[model samples]
Target chain A: MAPQSPSSARAALFDVDGTLVDSNYLHVRAWQRAFREIGHDVDAWRVHRAIGLDSSLLLESLLGDDADSLGDRAKDLHMTYYLGARDSMRPLAGARELVRELHGRGVQVVLATSASEEELDVLREVLSVDSCIAHTTSAADVDRAKPDPGVIRAAMDRSSTSGETAVMVGDAVWDAEAASRAGVTFVGLLSGGISRAELEAAGAEAVFEDAQDLLDRLDSSPLARLLSL
Target chain B: MAPQSPSSARAALFDVDGTLVDSNYLHVRAWQRAFREIGHDVDAWRVHRAIGLDSSLLLESLLGDDADSLGDRAKDLHMTYYLGARDSMRPLAGARELVRELHGRGVQVVLATSASEEELDVLREVLSVDSCIAHTTSAADVDRAKPDPGVIRAAMDRSSTSGETAVMVGDAVWDAEAASRAGVTFVGLLSGGISRAELEAAGAEAVFEDAQDLLDRLDSSPLARLLSL
Candidate 1:
């Protein structure tokens, strides 16, 4: 590849929920509550595996034909429970610092997730790193979600960076797979419940324990190396 | 572009329903019956635009959040009504001839549609050109649907052709937009009730009155010119 000019922008694309925010189990609980409220008992493992998917896709993935009547209600219930649970929301270790660190080093930061605008507002308030975030690609902005590359591609487009210039950091297989399929570099964090092996199997370039671990190892990470490219 | 050798394989990706089989109006009626049965009344015009989308997405598009109870049942109801209505389904003019013409010239033909396998089974029995078809990509084979490029990409992959070497022929704006997004050539047909202006606006390379008109003009069409490249 030809050397990129300094003017060519670079992006650090982050998946909001599990990677930076401590919300994987929270989502699981919320989904459980929603399902129970809608008169269904979905397995927590299935919902965990579906963490990074859009709500509709998640419901379809888990319940398949059984989610018909409960689709909208389940989502509404999850959102309600989740919103009520938001007071307990917190960023994973160094989540805000990592975004700030990337921004400090002139890397554009973009959050690529399937959360709706209202949901993102809550997440943004919790993360408190809005100034560092250059752009956000949400589910409402795209027809589909993670593992399909639509959200990641949208983030790349909004960040004005090509896939090769973006490093996607997340804590789920969907994020890793989406980045891999989109030809973007994928950095994985174990801040979420997903295993390192799973993330790597999904095509993560590097895996860290959490945002703080990634931040501490930034000098040796793909984002730092790519910037120096 | 470099010239494609005569031996280099090419593919014709046909979107069933309105593009070849004259079932767009049939689908609208089925959807209307299903939605009405589920207590919502959606217009036929709304159903026309949602033709190329996946069934779950179609319900969401028409009824919005009101499609919760109808998502799975609406599909079941549509399939039930549609199966009964299949006696009227027939391939559009020259549909079989066009598939045969492409196959005669050594170009593989693949069907790219969001219809379920059961629905495709019904559509295939109606079209009765199975021997000429190289492969078929259905909604069940993909994680997402038209306008997302999953089905088109899957068709190209199944047919062993790159997007540039594949031509997507359909009769809806969603089909045109999907082909455009996938970087495949798009040929639009007007039999599906979508206007020529709409298809062209969505980036169709050529528009025909129907499949027969495309077959009659095949020698002068982009599909022919590309195959000869």
Candidate 2:
């Protein structure tokens, strides 16, 4: 059941991959590069749908259970390559500023992503606003990644925010699905490469170009009233 | 990564709804009763696939985006009737004895269920084996209830078990899908009215007629050593 709203939310959950940073394409590129090196010809787009999934599940979704044929050798290959690509990380336009804005308004901001710890470290460095982050969740902390809401619950638990007092913003269908399943208001961001239709279909109640758009239109969104900004 | 294992596992995860208990048909019957009450005509088999899903999502899956118009109301009505029907709950033939056997052998047993807390109480009362259960999960704790691994993870976490240390047993394709997604070994139980091919297609590594059959042929099954008997 959806939690009853308190007229004001205490936090805003943000998806780190494509929603806060312009890295969904990079992840696709990295997975494609890694899979190719391991002798698998996987479609990058297909890899994208399964992006926010946990590592093994993502690989399984991409290469099937038989990818086990390659074993640990394949896992190391993907991690090393994906980590190497981290140098290309960049925050989506306005992500940093909006995060700061929310923090100023006393809204606890959390980073919930399906990215592994190694990936989040790079993101943390790139985003460079350590004080603004109230909490963060990665695949390491959750057994089932996005579209499951475990990370969201973990993040909320860390921030001490009740599900009723929180909202999630993300750019993928998985994010929308997770938010919907978790019974939170879902705000879709287009910067992550997922279409608005896909996000809406998954259950986003509102849409924006990215964090910047959200910040600019906060007054008209649930966020505006939520944080009284 | 596949959960790190200790060469061999001694614990197993069993799904509740259709696997150890013949409740899928009852769930379909209740849903049929509720859907019709709310003025929607949904096929029973289609509703059966949704058995493991959270009631609202199950309705949405069947009734689509606009399902709220009738689905929400129907869900309450369905549960209203199903809740009353709990007195009819019965354990599949070998379920009780298998739990007792597993308890005696010192093999850990856990329930990975999508049942509501209300339903779980009924099941516990009906199954009458409280001391043997090491862990249990309900829809309240997870987002993607099934066809996702959150419930399994919650159970594993509560049981202090890892994915590699666990083997999921269940009756439906969704249970197999969740266990597969979690990278756990899956054993299918036919008591839920699902077929062997369907279970295997969803990713079960083996199939058993019921808990007693599994107990009767424990030596033939890979999980035999993990059983308490």
Candidate 3:
């Protein structure tokens, strides 16, 4: 056979904090607890908007100039508080099975995330499908986070998947922004704080309620082909 | 008294890993070590090319098909091994003082990086000037890392700055590529693995030895006028 074109190999990249896992709410609670302890009043909804963004950017946006004043102490507190809640973290409904199914089919399944190694550990533990995920990304790995296509491109590059053949699945405008920048298809999930309108506006080709919804409607969408088993 | 034009308030963004800090060699070693233990014979120099990418992409590029097989255990090892060497990490020459001066002068020093919180903590401790950096990014913040501008844009957003007034200073091709994507000026540094030709090819506007060199010649460069204090 002639060599495969760069577009022949395809990959499906998923965001971990929300789309593939039900950790958005947990993150909100953790940030809420962290902020409250620091004597700052932050609404869960507001923090939710900041989810999917890099942690420092999220904190800086939420805390404003106070973020600078709080510095490492605040970051330390946020992580410390979040670690305490890690025991309860779980994969979003059908997420693990979906990833496993895709991996089984030889379609690369990567968890491209903004989570740190410590947080990735918690996710791996909670998901219990480490072997099933082809790759897991962390902040330590890339320069820019979501809303940038580097991670998605990285996933595509790793799997030898081309931008045209790859799809990025996530729950935030940032994911859509990234997929758009990478020139790939973006499938949005509503399990996170973002609304359908926001995801659509962010350039999602389709929006589903969560991993389960995407799974249920897989056959009806392009995701089925990209994530096919 | 009136609101300034967008350009008047623009800020300069700096990439930390290779641009401001001299940690690329350390990262290459860590990844090389991680890849070696996982039964792969990866060239450290090759790994250096993928330094600014997120973990999934890095692993994918380094491990290829074996990435799916090695899975998260290998990722865990990479993090564990990288963390072990964090203590010896340090900033590139004049990096700390330069970022501090920029911040002090209201230049809005933002660190765009792919490092996770744990890794960032190590870098922050080594640099010892966490309070001065306007923003610190990681893989978690972006859906992608460099060669993509999500983190840089986020930094601009957080500081209420814009691309016209912003400049991205770093030592790698990814940094230059990202700045190009974000519509910002890119100032390249020689301390990192990449060369001036490579940086310029990736879209860097000028090249310098490191932060100190940039600072030394700031007054005569377009960057000085753009930075506007």
**Chain A TM-score, each candidate:** 0.94, 0.90, 0.91
Clashes of each: 0, 3, 22
Where does candidate 2 stray beyond 4 Å? Answer: A1-9, B1-229
Full ranking by lDDT = 1, 2, 3
By summed lDDT, the worst window of 10 consecutive residues in model 3 chain A runs over A1-10
Error of 2 at A81 (Å): 1.7
Model 3: per-residue lDDT, tens digit, A61-131? 98888888774676788788778866445577778788876677667777878678888888888888877
Which candidate ranks first by lDDT, i.e. highest? 1
Q: What is the DockQ of candidate 3?
A: 0.01
lDDT of 1: 0.80
Where is model 3 chain B poorest over a 10-residue stretch in terms of lDDT?
A: B1-10
Tens digits of per-residue lDDT for model 1, B1-229: 2224534768899999888887776676677678778887553334656787866678788889877865888888888988887765767778889888888787888999878888899999988888888899887888888878989999988877887678999988788888988999999987775666677888998899788889899989989865674
Q: Residue A53, candidate 2: how far off, in angstroms? A: 2.1
Candidate 2: tens digits of C-alpha lDDT, residues B56-100: 668788778658687768878878888876754567778888877
DockQ for every model comes to 0.01, 0.01, 0.01
Docking class of 2: incorrect
